[model samples]
Target: MTQNLQYFLIPFMDWRIMLLLWGGVFAGIWVGAIPGLSGTMAVSLLISFTFSWEINDALAVMCGTFVGAVYGGAITAILLNIPGAPAAIATGMEGYPLAQKGEAGKAIGLCTTVSLFAGFVGVAALAAAAPIIARFALKFSPRDFFLLAVMGILLIGSIGGGDPIKGIMSGTVGILISMIGMDPSTGELRYTFGSLNLMAGISFVTAMIGLFGVSEALTQFRTSGAKSPKQNLTKVIPDWPTFKKYLPLAVRSSLLGVFIGALPGTGGDVAALLAYDQAKRTTRNPETPFGHGAYEGLVAPETANKGAIGGAFIPMLTLGIPGDAITAIIIGALFIHGLRPGPMLMIETPHLFWMIVSMLIIANVALFVLGLLSVRPFAKIIEIPKSIIMPIIIILSVIGTYAIQNSVVDVFYMTGFGVLGYFMRLYGYATGPMVLGLILGPMLDSNYRRTMQIAEDRLFPFVSGFFTSPLSFFLTASIVFMLFSQTKLYRKWRGIE
Candidate 1:
């Protein structure tokens, strides 16, 4: 125990290591606040630069960047409706409205507070329950993943806010768009339309920049010369009462994030969306209507995504499996550093495991401080005049889109999506469900196909498998309950309205 404590305290004891963690976190915030600059990209860049550095130093910086990047994505989501990362899509749904209402600072403050708590929750779960959670997560089959994606698709109704038919239409359009590239399994061309540029499929980041960033700029053109909302920055941090009110929700969402993040092939993006949907369904009397700046809406996704940071590390450290893209890069870094990550990794290098946990704790603390300091500046961005800000936003969108692949064709596609999203907004169609569909569509298609192959084209056996396995049964039942909750009968029985 003493040796383990010494190992964990090593980073804290060394000022250089601590300074590196803080520096990485600060850099990560700015990088992640910009669209198309992902944590994966930042970590990959660090891998190249930090190759000659000590493994401990490299891990400390990477850990800080991972935590800070996840938290920073919500910054743009709140102020500009442009999620810096896919995980912040749901955050934008609730947060952008708050920004428009001039409550961006308060919303962000609450987000930071909950994020810190959730980060600790995730770290605690990683420290105490990692092995058990990793073992349980490995039990998920492709069918279960498909079911999870289905559950994600069902969230369109919650995020849609109005006109279920229109929301479904938007979501369907996104899913179709997601199918444009070559099929990964069969290597067959999809909706490429004989164009070589289309064969690569549309990157979701480009779509996101266009759909949220560019479309938002275009929408503001209709209200040209209008003054932006004046945000109240006097009391940015939420009071004790406010924090207490949402504690249960933060805990629930964070735990959900941990479980989802621990699953291979899933990450904070899935976890955040799911938690947002759950909060929408379960919270009977939100302070404001969901999609219109509800505090509960902001709390759910923020907490979940932060918690997912810790969750992403669980499988990597315990099972040698990357929980998400960022972790996959971290896995490569581990191999480069001459450390093997597997079931025996903890036994062989217990110090490394504990040191990582220690580093994450420090990172979360840095995130809280930096997150609070950033809220005022981020909120002020919303107060900029539309005439000046809109064009700059469009330019940023273009730059972000082009940066994704350095393809001018992608910029054109982004402009097209921006036009489409603008029309959709004019027609009262919500863009959230569309983005959700794009994110989940591939997961749904690939997993369902794999499950079908395993079933050998037998529908009956495939259907029976849902009930035959305990995990599948639980997931199936949850789906059924979610579907039933959408009905008038269920709402009336529960006195929902």
Candidate 2:
């Protein structure tokens, strides 16, 4: 224990490492606040040059980037209705509304507070229950993952506009669009239509940029001359009472994030959405409506995504299995650093494990301090006139779209999507459901097909597995319960909004 303590304190003793962490975090915030730049993309880029650096120094920057990027996404989601990443989609639902009401600072203040709490919760879970959680994550099969996607599909109603039918329509279209590329198991194309550009499939980040960022810019043109909200920047940190009020919800959401993040192939995006939906289902007589400016809406997703960062590391550090894309890349970094990351990693090199944990804690602290200090300026973004800001958003959207793969076609796709989103909004269709669909659609397609292949295409056997496998049964039951929860009878009984 004493030696472990020493290892944990090593990062703190190195000023150069600390500086790298702080710089990486500060940079990550801006990167994640932009529409197309993502934490995964940023960290992947770091892997190339960091190959020759000391392992601890490389990891310090990566760890800080991971923490800051997740937190940074909420900044733009609140101020501009453009979520920096899919995880912040739910944040925009309430946050943009709050921003419009000139409460951007307060919303962000609460978000930063809960995010810090959630980050610690995830770190605590990593330190205490990583092996257990990793073991649990191993129980998930493709069948269970398919069922999980089905559960995500039910979130259509929760994120939908006032009209559930329109939301369903939007989500359905998104799912269809997700099927455009080659089949997961087979080399055959389903909807490519002989186009080279369509072969790689549409990137969800590009879609999200167009649907949320560019579409928002186009819509703002209708009221271009109207003055933007004069944001109130005072009170950038939530008071103790305010934090206490959200304590239970934050704990619940953060734990949920940790578990979801621990799941292989899942990330903060999925965790945040599920947390948002759960919060919507459970909160009673909320101070504001779920789709409006509800503080719970902000708290749940922000906390969950932050918690997911630690949760993601749990598996990567202990089990050699990456929880998400970023960690998968980190695994490659581990290999480059001449470290074997697996079941015996901690036993072989205990200092690495302890140092990573310590680094994350420091990163989270940096995130909170830096986030609070920047709230005023970030909030001021909402005060910019639409005519000036809208064009800039579109330009950034285009630049971000192109940067993803350096493809000119992606720029066209983003512009097309932006136009589609604008029309959808004009017709009372919320873009949220569609974005959810895009995120979950591929998961549903690939997992369902994998389960089918595993069952040898035998329908009866495939159906039986859901009933026979304990994990599948649980996920199936959850899906059933989710469907049932949408009914008026359940809502009336539970008194959920």
Candidate 3:
């Protein structure tokens, strides 16, 4: 293991790779802190640009970007009350309140520290568990995959915070939108409306940008004249006692991040939200308040989001299944280099796998420095007049959507979706579930059809088998109980449940 580890850490020893790695970190932070841009967009754009680069170099750059972008989102979330990525939505809840109270710098400091710690845990988990955990994950079948997707979708309802019905509705809409492309089972088109671009369906990246970036731009127009929050960024370091207090939540959230990340289809956004909720539930006494300027609130989500990086690599390395979208892109890069990631990858490309692990460590370190420097200067983002920011965001969204496939039709689709997002937000619906549904719907649809085909002779038996599977049973119970608890009847019966 030590010998293999050295091969992975070689990138760190090479000054050239280290410089490029850190450069990516800086780039990711700047891009992600911008209102209309996100880590996924940055990574996707990089993938196309780095097509000619060496596989290791391409991956090392992405590793840094991933780390920096996830943390960078919190900067904007704290300072501007706008999340740069969906992963920072939870951060915004506590982060904005802190900003309002003139504690933006403190919130950013704690979030950065926790994010760095969580990144280390995630990288360590990937290093220690990838071989063994991947083997276990490989045991999953199509049915397991379908169930996994469903479980991920269910989290939208959980994380919507106060409105489960709105969350579920948003998720349904997302699923329907994802179904617009050509059918997977047959060649028939579903909802292309005679347009050739719609034949490929709405790009997830485009939909995400429309839902977050574009919708946000519209909202900014409403608050165009509102004053930016006042700030006192002098006290940046988190106090010693405050740091000690958040340590437990950070560790606990990091553990949750690892498990959720290890699961197929689930990603950092879901992991972070779940961790945030858990931290709220676990607090015996309010330190600052759960939703308003709470330190733990920032710590939990920031930790979990970063921690998910390692956990996401588990299935990607061991089972040849990419754990999330970014990993899916990384898999493509591997294939381009004539390397296959799977069980044999351990024996055939052990060095490459290790190198990724080490690269993750370097990325995390870069994020720490970038995160700290980013906090003070980033606070000024909110000072940019909304009149200027909104138009710029809209322009960027148009460009990004059009660039996806070099099709103008996508611009129309993005605009339509942006309007949809605006109304959804106006009605107090959470967009998290919608994004989750978009990601998981295809996996669920295909896996369900495949599982049913496999169990043709034993339909009822197949349906009954999931009841005996521990994971399926646990998830089923969790979803059911969660839904039940959200009902008024359950709330009444439980005396404020």
Model number with the top lDDT: 2
For candidate 3, the C-alpha RMSD (Å) to the true structure equals 3.6
lDDT for model 2 comes to 0.91
Predictions ranked by lDDT, top down? 2, 1, 3
382-457, model 3: which lDDT tens digit per residue?
A: 5567777678768867876776667777787778777888888898986656776776778888888887888784
State, as a TM-score between 0 and 1, how close model 3 is to the true structure. 0.85
Better of 1 and 2 by lDDT: 2
Give all candidates' CA lDDT scores: 0.91, 0.91, 0.77
lDDT of 2 by residue, 74-129 (tens): 99999999999899999999999999999999999999889889999999999889
Stretches of model 3 off by over 4 angstroms after superposition = 34-56, 79-82, 161-164, 280-295, 335-340, 457-459, 481-497
Per-residue lDDT of 120-215 in model 1, one digit per residue for the tens? 999999999999999999999999999999999999998887899999999988899999989999999999989999888888888888888888
Q: What TM-score would candidate 1 get against the native? A: 0.98
User: Which residue pairs show collisions in model 3?
Assistant: none
Worst 10 contiguous positions by lDDT, candidate 3: 153-162
TM-score of each: 0.98, 0.98, 0.85
